[model samples]
Target chain A: MIEICEVGPRDGLQNECKIVPTAQKVELINKLIEAGIRNIEAVSFVNPKVVPPMADAEEVLKSLPKRDDVRFGGLVLSRSGLERALKTNVDFLHVVTTTSDSFNLRNAKRTVDQAVGELSLVINEGTASGKGVAGVLGTAFGCPFEGEVPLENVLKVAEKFLEAGCTEITLADTTGMANPNQVQEVVNSFLDTFGKDLSLGLHFHNTRGLGLANVLAGYQAGVRRFDSSIAGLGGCPFAPKAVGNVCTEDMINMFHGMGIDTDTDLASILETAKWMETVMERPLDGMLLKAGIV
Target chain B: MIEICEVGPRDGLQNECKIVPTAQKVELINKLIEAGIRNIEAVSFVNPKVVPPMADAEEVLKSLPKRDDVRFGGLVLSRSGLERALKTNVDFLHVVTTTSDSFNLRNAKRTVDQAVGELSLVINEGTASGKGVAGVLGTAFGCPFEGEVPLENVLKVAEKFLEAGCTEITLADTTGMANPNQVQEVVNSFLDTFGKDLSLGLHFHNTRGLGLANVLAGYQAGVRRFDSSIAGLGGCPFAPKAVGNVCTEDMINMFHGMGIDTDTDLASILETAKWMETVMERPLDGMLLKAGIV
Candidate 1:
């Protein structure tokens, strides 16, 4: 069984052009939890002025129903964001940086080294607060700005976070510029250095329509955990694509069809995606919702 | 090395709501030939009264610039359609039948047995005419009408076609309900029963977004020939799903990216898809055309 971290509320809603209300965000998270999603990226601790959709992250976090078993995480880029998340009941703080300093500078307004320094602070703070920390290594496969990032660069950053006591790391294809062979090669290189037991995850976008294909490669290469948005929703607001995130329902359907257990209720997850589509007033890039669970 | 028979002119245009003129149809085939497509399904000999888009099949075939090295084929359902194709310069004749009796009856107004009986005449005529014959087994994976088609049923039909001297068989997922695992299982079963080097082919639709994924599995299971459409321009018009046919450009990108040789010029193919977009006045389902040859 693979663990799927639902990133619909934070990543999916953050990229929407319209602002989703705090209550709806809470409801989406609750629905996901009800559907057996143990870990959910409920909110992003980013600036409200820049990303207006995530403006009510704190309020949404406050409104979440108390659930002892369900653990919710928040994406935090800077130490200030981490400090804010630490004040909330967020079970984990997700630290993000890139293998390419160029993408890091453009994406987070900080150099890779500087971002690693901030990550140390976030990891330490989360450790002090007894909350788990996950490092999201963005642009780990290839960077739009830097073109091809070296495998050594990705592993070095992951090592930094793990050395700082982070629980796990997620390799993200920020631009969806990855193919299956490349995914397998990079995953093999990561596991070769980091050992097989590392709590590794994969984050992919359906930009080039190879999202599920890449996931299969990653699975074959031995990475088990994955991050996906409900309706295949979410793209970077600054730089978007046709769609972002592999549709959770479609991935679940494929995995279930193959007898690879995901432990996700496909019907409930699909209903959440439909609700998300209704709230956003737009059709999502998911095929299962239209195909009716194959 | 794999052979990708361009089906944009036949299977593609046959589904278009508006009629694509004979001149433009010829140009699409010519452009594909220039881009190194050796096999082109240029026309369908079905009744123009029933499928108006393919009304000019003879006109399109006559207008095609003759290249002795390049082979052009036409799809024929009935013996009358086969006679029309035999009268034309079509180098190969394609026969199609469905695995499900219900689909065969609805699609061609004939039962599976009746269709296979018709296929015998098509094979014998093609053999006498000295033209290669290929059988398209529709719904070989599963049928929308029959729910789940048995493997033995699929092979029984193929065995009849092969015994009648059909050169190769193309398994088509007409409804695009196939997943990678199912695709692998079906392909493996076909290969195990039929022997290796059977000249097997795969035709997929992007209806459920698993077209390329299925292609990957088919390749892994020893299928070297594939059917694709330019700009992803075809669908089962009677039962369409967001523009079907696995995008030829996207498939090429994936194969080339993975170091598989597909002896086709991607730049010219993409230009053709772009030209097709202008001609059709619509964006295509293919990702590489929109993503710019990642």
Candidate 2:
């Protein structure tokens, strides 16, 4: 069985031009939970001036119905974001940094080393507060400014996160520049170095239309957890020419069609994605929504 | 190295509302040849009333540059279509039928067995006339109306094609309902039943967003020849909710990105796809065209 972490409300909506209402964000999360999504990155605790769509992260978190079966997460890029998230009832803190110094400087206003040092402290603090802290290495595959990121750089960050008491880590193809060969290589290296017990996840964007292919490669390489957005809603606001994330319903449809158990309902997720299309008031980047599940 | 047969002229433009000029079709073929594409399905010899975009099949074939390095194919559905193709300077005749009876009936106005019986005669005639006859089995994966097409049905069609002296066989996912597991299974089955010397190609649609993933799976399963369209332009006009074929430049980008060679120029293909977008007067379904080659 593969584990899917729904990132629709947070990562999906962060780059949208329209500011979705707090109620709609909460409602989308509820719909995902109803669709059997247990792990969700529901909101990001960032400044309203930077990402206005996530202005109500605390409100959205507070409004969500408490369920033992569900775990809601919030993205924290800096100490200020962590401070805001620690005060909320977020089930997990998605501590993020990138391998490219330029991307990290632009996104978090700090260098990669600086961001890593601060995030290590944040991870310790969040874990002490009884919240699961997951370290997300952005641009782990390649960076727009740096072109091809070194695999050693990605592994170095994962080691630091593991040392900082992070039980889970996610490697993000922030720019959607990853290929299947690279995905297989990275997944195999992680498993080889981390001894196959590390709880690893993969986050991908469909910017170049290789998202699901990379997901298939990762699954073949022994990685189980994946991050996807409803209606393919997300893109990196800081990355140039970035598009939506790997879609939730389409990825689910592929897994189910292949007889791989994702343990999520495809029909229910498709319904949520259709509802999200109306909320966004435009045609999103999902394919299964247009071509119904086979 | 993988062989890609460019199908932008026949399959891509067949379903378009606009009728592309014969001269422009010749120009697109010339552009693809300059980009190192050797095999191209330039035109389909069908009734103009059914597919208006391909009304000038003879005109397009006559205008193309007669280069020995390039092999241009024309789609032939019936004896009349084959007669039309044999009169032209087309290098190959792509004789086609489907695995599903409903699709074959709708597409060729004959049952699968009847279509096969007729196409076997067409193949023998084309071979006697010194033209390469490649058999294309449509809906070999699944049909929009018939749900799931059995593997035995697919194999039976291939056997008939081989017995009729077709050296090349293409398994087409006419409705885009194929999964990776199915692709691997079918490719393995075909290679196991026939010898490794058989020339097998895979054609896929991006209807459900599994086009490239399916391509990867097929490549991993040892099939080298693939059919793709410039700017991802083609869909089955008769199939409900069918979308575009796999994008040429994106697939090339994937193979080249993974250190696999297609021997096609990425920059040239992207320029052609962009030009095709202008020719179609709309944004096509291609991703690398929008995202640029990474």
Candidate 3:
């Protein structure tokens, strides 16, 4: 069995040029919950001035279906964001930093070490505040400004998060640059080092059509949790003309078809993708929505 | 090393609502050849009334850049089509028949057995005239009209073709219904049955986003040749909203990135894909074109 954390509401919506209404975002979350997605990245607690799209993160969280089983999380960039997330009822907090120093400075406005230091406090304080903390290493595969990201750099950041009491660590292909071989190599190293102490998740972008193949590699590497978005939303701003995260429905269909237990209903996810299309009033980047589960 | 027979000219253009002029088709072929593709399915000899897009097969064949190293073939549906191909100076002839009775009857106006019998004549005539002959088993994975295609039925057709002097057989996923397991099973069976006598090629559609995965499966099962299209053009007419064949550039990038040698220039293919996009006046269904080589 695998756990898929629906990041459509957070990572997906963040990249959209058109701002979706708070109510529709809540409805999307409710629909995903109805489709058996209990683990969700519901919001990003970043400054509204920086990313106006996520300004309504608090309202979206408040309006979501209150279920004991459904665990919502907010992605945080700094200590303030983490403090803000601790005030909310969200069950978890995800602190993110890039592996490349150049990308770390450009994306987060902080050096890799500074961001890692900030995330360590986020992890320590959030855990003390009775909330599970997840450490996300973005650009772990490759960086847009800096071409290749060293695997050792990614591993060091992840080790810091693990040492700082992070419950889970997510290795993210922020630039859509990770291939199956590289994904397997990184995932295997993480499992070998921190598999006993920390749970691992993989976040991928479908920009190069290797997203699901990377997922298959991760599965083979004994990592079960993945991050996906409905309609493959969240276009990459750094990479011009890049597509979004892996389509949630397409991943589920492939996994279920492969005889792996995804436990997520594909039909329901398709319906939510349909709703997402309608709300966005545009065609989204997805395979299952276009192909209709053949 | 793997052999990629680009089918962009015949299969990719057959489904286009707009007819690509004969000169443009030849240009596409020339561009593909310049990118290191030696084997190309350059034309189709079906009746112009049935598929008007391929009406200029004779003209296109006449205008092709004749080279000894580059092998071009025409797809023939019936014995008359085969006769037409024989009239041309092409290197090979590919005769096709579907495994599913309903699809065969509807597409070719003949039952599976009747089409196979007719194609046997195609193979005999083409091989007798010193041209390499190939038999393509369409719907070898599954049929849209009929749910599942038995592996025995597909192999039976393949056996008839092999006995009829076909040196190559292509198992085509006509409706994009094949999963990786199915691809592995079918390729394994073909390798087991005609290990010494024949080479096998696998064709796929990207409708379910499993095209690359299927290719990976076929590779693991000991098959090396594959059929792909530039820009992922040519939608399936039977399967509603079905996408096109796997994009040739994307497949090459994947195989080459995974330490498999394709010997094709990635930059040159991307240039051809760009030219194709200009000719079609629309963006194509390819990932590498959007996200340039990382």
What are the models' TM-scores? 0.96, 0.98, 0.96
For residues A1-294, could you state the per-residue lDDT of candidate 2 as single tens digits?
989999989888887767799999988999999999999999998787888888898899889998988999999987899899989999999998999898888877788889889889999888988989999999999998889989898899989988988989899999889999999999999999998898999999998999999999999999999999998996543454668889999999999989999888999999999999899888778998889889
Docking class of 3: medium
lDDT of 3 by residue, A94-201 (tens): 889998889878777889999888789888888999998889999988898888788888999998998888878999999788877788888878877766445889
DockQ of model 3, rounded to 2 decimals: 0.59
Best by DockQ: 2
Q: In terms of lDDT, which candidate is strongest? A: 2
Model 2 chain B worst lDDT window (10 residues): B233-242
C-alpha lDDT score of every prediction, in listed order: 0.85, 0.90, 0.86
Encode model 1's per-residue lDDT on A1-294: one tens digit a residue. 988988888877777677788888888888898888888998888887777788777798889888888888898888788778888988888888887989888777889999998788889878888988999999987888788888888889999999998989999998788888899999888888888888899998887778888888788789889889998887543453445788888888878867799877989999988988898887777777677766
Candidate 1 C-alpha lDDT tens digits along B72-133: 98998888898898888889888999999999888888899999997888898887888899
iRMSD for every model: 2.0, 1.8, 1.8
Clashing pairs in 3: none
Ordered from best to worst lDDT, the candidate numbers read 2, 3, 1
True contacts kept of each: 0.46, 0.77, 0.48
Score candidate 1 by lDDT.
Answer: 0.85
